[model samples]
Target: MRPPVRLALAAAAASALQIPLQPPNGANVQPVLVESDALADRVGAGNLQKRAEALYEIAELSVDEYGHPTRVIGSRGHLGTINYIKSTLDGLGGYYNLSDQIFSAVSGSVYQAKLVIGDVVPSFTTMGLTPATENKEPVHGDLVLVGDLGCKSSDYPDTAMGSILLIRRGECSFGQKSELAGQAGAVAAVVVNSEQDEIHGTLGAPSPNHVATFGLSGATGGGFIEKLESGEVLDAIAYMDADVDIIETMNIVAQTTHGDPDNCVMLGGHSDSVTEGPGINDDGSGSLSVLEVAVQLSHYKVNNCVRFGWWSGEEEGLLGSNYYVASLSEEENAKLRLFMDYDMMASPNFAYQVYDATDAANPVGSEKLRDLYTAWYEDHGLNYSLIPFDGRSDYDGFIRHGIPAGGIATGAEGVKTEAEEDMFGGRAGEWYDPCYHQLCDDLHNVNLTAWEVNTKASTFALSPFALSTTRSTANAGWV
Candidate 1:
């Protein structure tokens, strides 16, 4: 059960923010049984496009200090995103119960730093909550390579003392790597990306025991590793002038009031974007897609409850979703039968990718959700591929606590292969969404065709789960 005080305060906040709550629409219409095809057919491109444009306009109206529109958590743009979702649902006529889950997320206050290796200054991202350099002076030292991933103490060499450590990112938090480096007597740490893309990470919290750390792209780091392996000596300079601040944010959760509460089908996407851009395709695409589904779903009565969550602070390491799961009671946790996360649903160079729930980390019965999603694309004669069901999105919280979870994504920051090009008909070697985290991820960044297909896929995947008692057998009958 939601706390009465919290709900009251949330309502008060909405009122103070002047968010318009509309009367329920078509309250007298009789709800029909939820059939997969029928629900999926209701997902239209026109409405989806309108929502996309609305989100883009919201971002445009909420500019940051740089005059760039952003929906980062606690910003006017994100607040508008929240209001837009709330008002859309409120117009549905009391078919759903709405609540706000509030929390605080701590992030780096600023970034005024650089990392120079040899004579080259590769593009880099500053790690969150890491310490600033002393007096803003760049520390120059010999770059000592840490063995393996540097997750364990044995990986640090004795030569690391008084030197800058080059650590590969994997199997550990940035904080842990920095802590181990500090213990090894290293002055600073440089973590290389594990993938082809750039690495932007957080230390989870302020770590006073940690030395200053930085992140580098995979290509740049790989070059450094190759040189070091060939017995090349390298000099490095690292500096970070930064601090931390806590931002107040909240998650918007709405559930169908008429369905069985004990068995719920939950769907979510983060509402906040990176501070760099509007993030329409990165997440506004997913967020608005879910919003349109919620609006359409209001006309139906389900056997199982359907909950929708618009999470905040996901760009800061899924803090909003993490806080929500942690705040749930055992009984409340059990009420959630399954969770589906939709992120980056409309990448310009899009490919239909379903979450591979067969990974050992997920709970039992998750594969059924994957099967349901893939079957939808297959039935429609569409091409789809399996992506790792890693804890990179809001679903991370649900999966960690043994909840069965799955979802779809277009793609982000990942290079598309030639085979994927043959499968989805886009140019190979380019990023699935080149705009990704940049300011260019605006309305035009979305591929409308891909967005429509995935939105329909979401409708198909979610309908049966809302009507069945168990996750396993729900989609089997429908597909």
Candidate 2:
């Protein structure tokens, strides 16, 4: 535990008063209250752009067989990302305590997944967590269309036996469809996108009960269905090759050296990306923003401990975050006053949205956090919206354990509305970020203005807590 408070001018008086005496700088001087506006003013577009460009260049360190650059877990690009963050923090002259949290997690990659019907090879991609076909060889079967959405066991007919099942993507998860089909004697599962575009998704997690699951564009899958409805026998062959194994990766945890360790404020963002792209806007924006804030924050002093987490394995699942939280001791968990998550801060078509903290499920003081973000936007004359307090990002682990959690996000795959367009001046009926998970999500994908604004908002919300956690008075003071 930290030594009891001491007054600088009264070493003799403090001893006479029975207060503990400690290091010259320890508890002797009045703690500085970090103001939102002043600290937030330090965040700018120029610096963020430099960080974004640096991350993009780091991503180039790892290229897949298809020549696409990525920072997926266990890859060179991701390792470079980890190293860059560590070296930057170390350069802070020991202002923060850094810990490299290493752990083993399941990682999967699909190199080849092809579906052929008759003489045509349809365009397809394998879903995450999908298994390789038996013997890593081709499996030929008759194409059989499953009824409805194919989420139910009865959706797979007896005719589906020894055949490849064609299922539509909707109303259920890909893993559930694959599991139901495999139980009905289907050799493989082809899930067609509900939309016109090609589907890119995960089965959510690995399961031996799942068959080789592949995603196809709605148009291509519809063509096959029409042929099947006409009572035509379509012969099909599916070849899928994937590597799923346990790999060692890490989460970077850093905390301020000065402050009450028992009272902490935490901020985090995922550090890894999907295999498809460099993932600049998806999370590189958030990760770098947090890193930049931590760097700038070192210039000031804090009362409550401030911790930053750069989580891995978020793209595959909330693996890193979940693991970290579960490993925390009960006492450690109690030290965390609140948790904030930052993600996709630079969506090309952006809307300033804060997490709704008034939700019945959210813990107390969450509304205060929500107020901080909305207040930041309002104080700056910037309009904002409220997104569901859903566990979609790295905030999942914290909120599950009843910790008050809140943050802001520009957006991701969700579509923008006309109202949002008016406020943000972007096209309606379009994704907040069109290149969200695609290879096009490079340095060119981020909107520097949106990134800077959101980063400042995050800074504003985090600064006050650094001065004094709502649960503690050790560092309480006005700026």
Candidate 3:
């Protein structure tokens, strides 16, 4: 530690003008999660204005970074999105020196094509669905309508044989969709966007014998319907390319082993995304936000061993994180204080959300993020919501290990509810991020408020628990 004068100079320069270095009580500091008056007083008007500006730039960069074709596990259109993430952390310049952990999502290849009004090349967006390079054959058939062909919804007449079945995307995993399509007698499936605002027209799953999968924009579909009404040919072609092997992807990790070795605190976020989209907000925001925090804190010699992880193969399933947890020795895992995963922290239009787990009835994670978020929102006077933890995040790994894990996510794949609209003030029935998995999910599409809520909420709650993780590890020994 430096001398009193040097420390004072360092604090003055390092602390955000709004936030002082030490607590009003001096050495005994209050955690930001508590929203103490001291904190509120420090974060005055000018300081907030500066913070908001910094936040906006970060959000823009995150969104910009996410959709830049960074596909881990390498698929069609998945460029160097992963590389950018790695580089960003490296460029952030710190000792949290990045490391990579590779894993596989393990899915079959898929191919897709489309046929709209002939002599007219129908407008389309070729999403992740790659046309099967190995198995391509010409087949023509009447379009069949298959509603929600989830893995369990064995309701659609088998459409995998020869006919073209029209299936809408919903309620099931992409892998499940491929399986369902294979079981059906249809040669290929044309999966149209379930919503009018869908950025991509078709969604194809990886599968064997999956012929051609195709997409038509909502507008194109409406026009096709008009053509059908007028007795015109609404013919189209689709193919599901299923010839690729399971591609292994890499995740970056950097460890700051401090605090108590027995108790560990983990910080992480996914570094991959859908084929067409850059995945910035879907995760870029959280990635950068967490990365920034990690870089800043890495300089400090803290208590409790801390690990920073960047997950891969999250777009397909929670695979990378799951594997890491599985690999840890039972004893090595015992000291886990908590896991805090930040996912999609910068939704351009996200409403502040919290994982509503361990309620008054049950307490989860370090201390249920509920109160932390509630206080943060109230102190800021922002709209807030608490949603259940449904294993939708990377924390799924910690949960599987019976470790109390908590996480923060600004928005993703699902649409917002009506009540949510009333609170956020966006279009009435649209999803929080329409550009979620599209190439359009670029840096330009970040909501300022959403970014702040996620970053601040996570930092405020996580830092204290992280610093004190050893307590949890100690308690775990008794359990």
TM-score of each: 0.87, 0.86, 0.70
Tell me how candidate 1 scores on lDDT.
0.81
Maximum-TM-score candidate: 1
lDDT of each: 0.81, 0.81, 0.55
Per-residue lDDT, model 3, residue 304, is 58
Question: Model 3, range 1-479, lDDT digits (tens) per residue?
Answer: 11111112222222322222111221222233222232223323232234333333322332332334433345322224344444445544453445766555543333344454445566654434333522465556656555444445465665435666555556764445545565675665555555554434222335564445555556555555455446665444543333334555666777653356676677788766654555657676776666655644543455556677877666666767887888778897876656778888767657677776563333245345556667777887778787778787788878767676666666664578788888877764666777877667765667756675566666676556555533433433212
> Order of candidates by TM-score, top first?
1, 2, 3
For model 3, what is the error of residue 191's alpha carbon versus the real structure, in angstroms, after optimal superposition? 4.4
| lDDT by residue for model 1 (281-310), tens | 979999988987887776667888899999
lDDT of 3: 0.55
Alpha-carbon shift of residue 90 in model 3 (angstroms): 6.5
Which is the winner by TM-score between candidate 1 and candidate 3?
1
Candidate 2 lDDT over 200-233, as tens digits, reads: 7777677777899898878788888888889988
Clashes of each: 1, 0, 47
